[model samples]
Target: MKEIPKKNGFTTPPGYFEGLSERVLNKLEEKDTSALPSKEGFKIPEGYFDGLEEKIQDKTLQRETKVFTLKPFRPFLYAAAAIAVLVVLIIGLEKNNTSTPTFDDLAQAEITQYIESRDLELSSYELAEVLPVSELEIGDFMESSVDQDEILDYLEDSIDDLDELNIETHEEYQ
Candidate 1:
């Protein structure tokens, strides 16, 4: 298939560029020089500038003689500043007084729910950092529920794993 050649689709007004400079010069020549006034046509009083310095000094003295006073809203500005300080103090104290939630503070149901939610992504060491176990704190764990015999039995069973870890660590150091 043969493609048609496309035109630019633009056109100029007749005589737009022709004799533009001559037309502009003729317009300039048409203005009359004599009819237009050259002077600014302003006149000053004879002694006006003579006491200008004294007049300015007199105005300055008038202003200086008046006493300066506070604006009507100045007290309100002080009140707002005081209120802002009070609000900051209140917020600061509230944050300071709030206690950190310990294991003892959490309910069994909430603790179970939190555990079941699978939200904790921590390793055992990281979880230990979060929940440090003191003797008293450990007593509170499992609702003070597990028997002493069961605890001893579990510890005895885990002692083998602990011994293996110690031997591995000793070999690594040597």
Candidate 2:
């Protein structure tokens, strides 16, 4: 084939066309040669290649993939640890507590001593039958009764018969 000179923007050298045909025959190949100047040799007019085009490209709305990573459940772990520690501390405190004497213990001794010391006065009548421990309740029962003298008299007369009566020793006689 006769070689033809290239013209206009779609032009290539006759040898370059021949090379392209050869490349087609061999396999598909890209045409790297352009009718325009190479990028390295390209020079723009003053202020021609400003950042405006880049700014426009950036402003163009487009979908972007965003990845979000959630933080670990460390706070919950700390809270659970605190709760467990609190529970353990509460249990330890409970276990370490010693048995303390209640009001019942204190009142029991006082009541027993009072009764034994004045058994002769108290046993005369069936005072225990009328006023039992279950009826007396847990507090000061004698503090509210209106017949204190009658109660004392009954106790004295009842216990006077007993040989253990030490009423004379309790008197302040000279």
Candidate 3:
């Protein structure tokens, strides 16, 4: 297939550009001579500029603003800011300290639940090692319902030989 040649689609009058610059100049001259005023309408009053600087200075001096200096109170402001920061720090520290839970604050059931969930195998001797043994008294043990007979029965059933019990005397313990 043959490709057709492309042509511009725009057109103008035969003499449009013949005297374009002259026509524009003539129009500009007509507008300048007839449409626009010869001089601007603004007019200055007589002697207005003579004392203008003095009038401006008088007005400025009459409207003089009060100047404040922070130099006098700067130290007081710094001290107040420091005190505020210290108060906030002390209050924050107090709140944080109170937020921590203590051992005595824990419920017995909660402790038991935690131990059972972890499946800990802590023995009585291991528990005793952590206990405050110095606070215990003979009367504390005597408060138990178990009598001597029951204790002897338990020992007799559990032990096979007397030598197996490495019982210590008070003097030996001392």
Candidate 4:
């Protein structure tokens, strides 16, 4: 076949195609328009490729969001961790409280020693004056009181008897 001169983009031979025999031209036209085997071997499902592309784009967006969203909660996480550590230390130390003496317990022990001592001179001035009171008078009134055992009991019993006997009767009611 003679080569064709290109006009615009077609590379057909100029008068050669025009002078082509009818049967050859017809056969050439038929072959040109005939469909080749479909490219179905490499084909994917219709919307699968588009969905995959969308999924990729969504994953990229999610990654970007995660990268940018981390800063604000970092301080809170650190504070919570610090608080947890402090709580653990406090709980560990609190477990040993029974071994440690509280101020109130020490005071109570000291007061008891002062109260039970033989020598009144060794007692505090406050306890020394009240030491002469008898044990029987100390029990009924100050049974539950820790600090003042003797004088408080005597005074409390006296006050209760006085309160019971001093009741006033209204003349109108009588």
Candidate 5:
């Protein structure tokens, strides 16, 4: 039981395949055609050929009495189940979504939910990789409403806070 044997036990003598064709051909050549069975050991039932028409008529002429049974509406049941799954999926996809949240009404909880739900297409890190919002050139806003003097005055007022924050300033490269 411990040591399993690898041998198959069945083996052929040496030169088995070498003369196989010649041996088979010799046996076939030695066969006596006259000694072969004439009826091939088969027999037809008595009166089988004589009553062929009657037997065929008995099967063909009679009504089959089919009850028009369905296999318990199995295919239709599967189709209905599939349609129900599709309907549920469609309804769920439709109802799960909501309208965009308005900025004025937007709270910290809504922002957190939006982030957690992955509703925002890009994260803040991805947005930073694109043009930073500060570097954007908005010609419409710059030409009309923006006042350089007012901006300078605001910056002068909060110069102390800017220094306190230790923010790095960009050096002009010319």
Candidate 6:
């Protein structure tokens, strides 16, 4: 068995490439010299170029301009904002106005217990000073339900000598 050598099957004649470029140029020149019109039937109308700039400007100016505004919705927006504020205020007031206990609502025993538990260092004079003088009346103190015997007993137990007591009478005021 013999091995065949690989060879290109296509071949060109001698000097084919050397004359290729010259042949192509000659064909182009022949086409150029033929009796065909250069414009190939496409023609621009007269005065078309003269008015092109003005025509473009006129077309641009004739286009309607788009305008956007919030003017129509201004009142609605303001109303919505005001409604939001009112709603917020209403909710806030509802929360704040919930039934909070006032000093008058507390029982006397509860008030006394609270004062005793806190061990406040304030004296009776200091407590009296804090009370508004305008609100106090002689009946407020005199109207207490304590028995006169109990008062005498408490005073006797608290005081060693009656001579030290500075009792004031209504006659002394005159």
Ranking by TM-score: 6, 3, 1, 5, 2, 4
lDDT of 5 by residue, 36-133 (tens): 66666877889789979988998889686878876574688889999999999999988876665577587646765777798668867885686346
TM-scores for all predictions = 0.24, 0.22, 0.28, 0.19, 0.23, 0.30
Which prediction has more favorable TM-score, 3 or 5?
3
- What is the C-alpha lDDT profile of model 4 across 53-168, one tens digit per residue? 87887777745334455556468888999999999999988997757666546654576676578565554667646554454365444657555445445656677563565655
Task: Check candidate 5 and list the clashing pairs.
Answer: none
lDDT of 3: 0.78
Angstrom error at residue 33, model 4: 95
Any runs in candidate 1 off by more than 4 Å, and if so which?
1-31, 62-143, 146-174
Candidates, ranked, lDDT: 6, 3, 1, 5, 2, 4
Give the TM-score (vs. native) of candidate 6: 0.30
Q: Report the C-alpha lDDT of model 2 over 31-132, residue by residue, as the tens digit.
A: 444654656676668876788798788889685979787896678899999999999999999888867777556775686777788755656356667445
Q: What local lDDT score does residue 88 receive in model 6, on the 0 to 100 scale? A: 100
> In model 2, what lDDT does residue 133 have?
51
Compared with the true structure, what per-residue lDDT tens digits does model 6 show for residues 1-174?
Answer: 887768878888998899799998898887866575666687788988998999899978867778787557468888999999999999999999899889779875786688889979999999778756797666666657776567666877899975578754244322
Give per-residue lDDT, candidate 1, residue 89. 100
For each of the candidates, the C-alpha root-mean-square deviation to the true structure, in angstroms, is: 16.2, 27.8, 16.2, 25.4, 15.8, 20.1
Best by TM-score: 6
Regions of model 3 farther than 4 Å from truth: 1-24, 62-174
Worst 10 residues of 1 by lDDT: 165-174
Give residue 154's lDDT in candidate 4 (0 to 100).
64
Q: Which prediction has more favorable TM-score, 2 or 6?
A: 6
Deviation from native of the Cα of residue 67 in model 3, angstroms: 13
Q: What value does the lDDT take at residue 43 in candidate 3?
A: 92
